[model samples]
Target chain A: MGIVNVKKDNFEDVVLKSKEKVLVDFNADWCGPCRMLRPILDEIASERSNVKIVSINIDDEEDLAMKYGVSSIPCLVLFDGGKEVNRSVGLIPKDAVIEFIGE
Target chain B: MYDIIIVGAGPSGLTAAIYGRRANKKVLVLEALSYGGQIINTLKIENYPAAPNISGFDFATTLYNQVKDLGTDIKFEKVIEIKDGIEKEVITTKGSYKSKTIILATGCENRKLGIDREEELIGRGVSYCATCDGGFYKDKDVAVVGGGNTALEDALYLCDVANKVYLIHRRDEFRGEEGLVDKLKEKNNIEFVYNSNVTKLNGDDKLSSVIVTDKEGNDKEIMISGLFIAVGKIPENENFRKLINLDDSGYIIAPENCHTNVEGIFVCGDARVKEVRQLVTAASDGAISATEAIRYINERK
Candidate 1:
């Protein structure tokens, strides 16, 4: 499946209440690195059948960004069982992203 | 298993892919960021041979297309770790794969100023790359921190876009070439802030001003909409620390010939510890590393 666009209303059902692990990408349109990172995230979503990939626009979701302490673009936060298990900042390679997700 | 898994799609990694694929070996290139590496940030590249004068963006695009047409697989993935064995295992954020040899070409990233709110202000007016985000501050005041070639180049590039550019350097003397320094001095809108460090960033939602401190403990607040940090670059080799040897500065310890501590693992580009880190050198290293990798695979067979 393709990546899901996450927002305030579906934050609970899409991310927090999901059965499988969820990867939340905090990004914005103007962020250059974030734009570069989009295709990579989509590739990951296509490869992983069980993991759910979602993106939250920081400009539109300032409250959620503040709640997660997201100060940077292209930030990937991994959630498992409704809790944050891991996260990474800046532009990184795919292997690094998988390692950040843990085994 | 595949023949080679090249990490990073910069000039070096792409160059290596060209060689590896031509040799009829199965090759895959994994890149974390954009395919161009640091060269994409450069506006013009005259030093690269045969190119005469070409924009870095065009150069990178041309090279990338060449590699793509060669049937070499290029994947955009963040590499998490590498496991060295008879068949090396490359673990990425997307998935894991095994290859007979691995070539590391992951380049360096911009160094941070280490000031408070610096990390928190990224994209919110604090940027390390001028070419990527300079347009956001068009006709607005901005500051660049560094005395090196990168910093000087950034300031000169911003002079045409930003209304005013503040070049902040900790030393009175610049480390860049004299030619560029002279050109920077000629710009009327560019102001040099020497012998000072950007100690603080002031703004709640975004960066509004910066407090630069001199060696004598004096601080001056400069109003600006953006801060371009070009102090220097550091190798992003933390992931391969377990599989390869690194220097004190975290650079992969491959003094020469792209030979790493591991038998089948090779390193190239800016990530390796070397005296010179340039586009040509990186491309040369890629050629050498791929050649050596091909030799290793043939010998094993």
Candidate 2:
């Protein structure tokens, strides 16, 4: 499956209630580095079956971003069993994502 | 195991991929961020031999395309650790790859403006890369801190985008090229803040101003939306420090050649100990390290 674009409406079902591990990417449309990171995250989403990749636009879901304490764009927060296991800030490579998810 | 695993996709790493692929080795390049590295932020590179005054983006694209044509596999990943042995295990954030030889070209990160709330307000209003975040401050005031070519270039680039640009430096004299300094001086919106340093970043949730202190210990707060820290960079060798010998400043100690303390692991570019760090020198190191790595692999075979 491809990466999922998340919003406030269905975030509870798709992320909090999901069975598999979730990788939530917090980003904005105007962020240049965030744009660069999109394709890389998509590539990872395509390759990984154990983990689910999703993106939450901070502009659209400001409350979700504030709850997560994401001070930077392109922030990746890994959640397992409905809890945050790890998080990374800034635009890091794919290996970092794998490492962040404890894979 | 593959023949070679090159870390980083900067000028040095990309150059290595070109050389390694030509030698008929299965080369894999793992990059932490974008393929272009720091040069992608550079506006114009005037001295990159035979390609005078070429844009950094164009130069990196050409090199990346050349490496792709040669069949060198490029992976975007952040390498977390390296297990050295007969067959090296290069562990990244995403996955692990084994290779006979490893090229450690993982480059440097922008030196932070270590001050209050600076780290906390990274994307809010404080940024290190002008090219990446300059658009956000369009028609707004921004301050760039540093005395190097990158600082001067950032100021020049921001002059076109931001309504006002403050070039903040600790010393009165700039270490950047005379041409760039002159160009920055010509920009109508650019203001020079000589012999001063940014003491603190002021604002909550978002940066609204910065406290700049001069030589006389006088503090002046400048109201600006963005603060671009262009103050050079530090080697990003924290992850591989356990397996490699590094200098006091955290640069990989490759003294003369690219060969590290490990037999099969070699380092090149700004990540390694060196007197000068430039685009041309980084490419040169890439060629040298790839050649040395190739020889090592050949002798083993």
Candidate 3:
């Protein structure tokens, strides 16, 4: 499955209410690390079928970023259900990303 | 076994890979985090000889591709331990590999404030990279702590986006370039807080204010929506402390030749003790370390 670009409209259904484990990437266009992370996330999305990957542009959705207290870009928050289970800040490698999701 | 196994795929390690492969040696680069190291977060790299005005991401990607095209094997596994012997064993989080020579290029990481609730406040009010998190504090008051080039650069960048910027340093003088300090002085929105250190972080859910203690032990509170900490960097050489010699600050004790105390193990980049830790110097170290490793391998053969 392809990575999902989430906004306020589908954030609830695509991330919070999803049956599968979700990895929501909080990012911005101007962020260099966020740009570096895009291809890696795409690779993960293509390889993994059990987990759902989504990207949320904080600039477009300020309210959602604030609600999640994500002051940092390229922040990866893993959601098992409707709640945030684990999070990793800043840019990380593909293996680290997989380990994060597995944990 | 591979001829060389480079730990960390930053500029230094990647450059070493290019050199190692060009010499027809089998090379493998194991990186814990993403390739490119700290340079990826940088917006623009003005210095670095011919690569002027190039974005850090572009530079890193080009170099990464160059290394890949050279037939160097790059793995995304964090090196956990290194067993020193004739054939060095490099152990990572996932698995292990044996090599004739090893290059320790594990770079440094952001130094934390070590203040109360600082860890919990990350992504709420505390940030390490201004370029990545400055947008969140747009038009909001922010404070940057540190006296190095990174801190000065962060303050300058934040001044454009933040309503007000407080550049706080523990010393009266800044260790960054004079040109950067001059540029910061011209910004009306940037305030220099010297001879002071952030002693406490205030707020429950998020940061609201920080208490700074001056040289005279006077405590003052500065209200801000964000705090960008760029004090300095700490070397990632703790894993190899048992196998290599490190200086007082934990940087690998390697001279300009990038030769570690161990016979075949070499160190390079920000992980090594150096006077100047710039991108160009890192590339220089990469070349030197690779050449040294090649010579060592040939002599043993």
Candidate 4:
């Protein structure tokens, strides 16, 4: 479908596993770079459901962040089978993400 | 009508007022508590470029005087709520007030321990701010919880006065900068206990000790005269909840220019979500909000 708003309630089911690879973007609405990076993420998510793009707001689920060892944003983590396989911190080009998912 | 009204008079609010007033806007600042907000409790602020060594209280006083000299209208009263109209308005606990545009610079409050007796024991012994109360524990043993930048910074600040400081954290590694970790370790008075959480506070009328649970689920009591909880903070967005679109963390959703969903309403500082929650960054947000607020007010006119 589309990007699912991940919360403490459903973080496990969505980010953990699905038929497709998941890319989780941990960001805050007030962050300037997060705004700049939003459209790129939306574009990528719209193109490929094989790669689910989920944005996590640390302010909402601080405990989930503590569990994930996230100290900074915008942090992008890739998950498969309930485990984080890769992660990148700060903002990057959309092409970089496209390459990340091997698209 | 005034061009802008900035709520809260902390660094962000004051700085925003300065820019707004300088931009030729008739600005009024509404403050609930004392003007400086949390800065009054700060002992020293070495980071705000140019002034290498300045007490937060003194620096804030200087800012206060500067804004006042510029003829900024300041009202010392709590803002109960904000009414968003064609032009946003802010109502105080005292009376009703209106503005052409409003900037929300209200900062965050320290998160409480949430444990029983913590509130009753507050001021008696338990505290969240080290700079505010660390002086009382001079030459005595004290405890600081959390591993964030604030926690580490407070622990380091307490190291100067307290004879011994016990820095407790649930993680072995700190979430703060590496340089700070090294600095705190150099202090002979600082001792670190990793993979542990604060369970409870054991105290009498004045001050006493604390109970901590290790990662292994073992809990133990340690004798101490003071306890400081620097774990973290939650944004003070409850007041403006109905007026703005706050994300899950209760932080107001301000765009890149600090403009919220409602017209003529802007949010800055700790009340909004941000990647870096440093003092300098908050000051920058204030500056940005002012420039953008001018443009916003002008566009509507």
Model 3 chain B: which ten-residue window has the lowest total lDDT? B234-243
List runs of model 1 lying over 4 Å from the truth.
A1-103
- Candidate 3, residue B280: Cα displacement in angstroms equals 1.0
Task: Report the Cα lDDT for candidate 1.
Answer: 0.88
For model 2, state the Cα shift of residue B102 in Å.
Answer: 2.0
lDDT (0-100) at residue B253 of candidate 1? 87
Fnat of candidate 2 is 0.31
Candidate 3 lDDT, B190-280, residue by residue in tens: 9899999999999987899999999999999999989999988899787788879999899999889999999999988999999989899
In order, what lDDT does every prediction score? Answer: 0.88, 0.86, 0.91, 0.80
By DockQ, highest first, what's the ranking?
A: 3, 2, 1, 4
Candidate 2 DockQ category? Answer: incorrect
lDDT of 1 by residue, B43-96 (tens): 578899999677766778799999999999988778999999998999998899
lDDT of 2 by residue, A1-103 (tens): 7988999888889999999999999987656457657888888888889999999988789789867765467778888988998777677766666788776
Ranking by lDDT: 3, 1, 2, 4
TM-score of chain A for candidate 1? 0.96
Candidate 4 ranges with C-alpha deviation above 4 Å: A1-103, B186-190
| Docking model 4 quality class | incorrect
Model 3 off-target regions past 4 Å? none
Better of 1 and 3 by DockQ: 3
Please write out the lDDT profile of model 3 over residues A9-61, one tens digit for every residue: 89999998999999999988767788889999999999999999999999899
Checking candidate 3 for backbone clashes, the offending pairs are: none
**Chain B structural similarity (TM-score) per candidate:** 0.92, 0.86, 0.96, 0.91
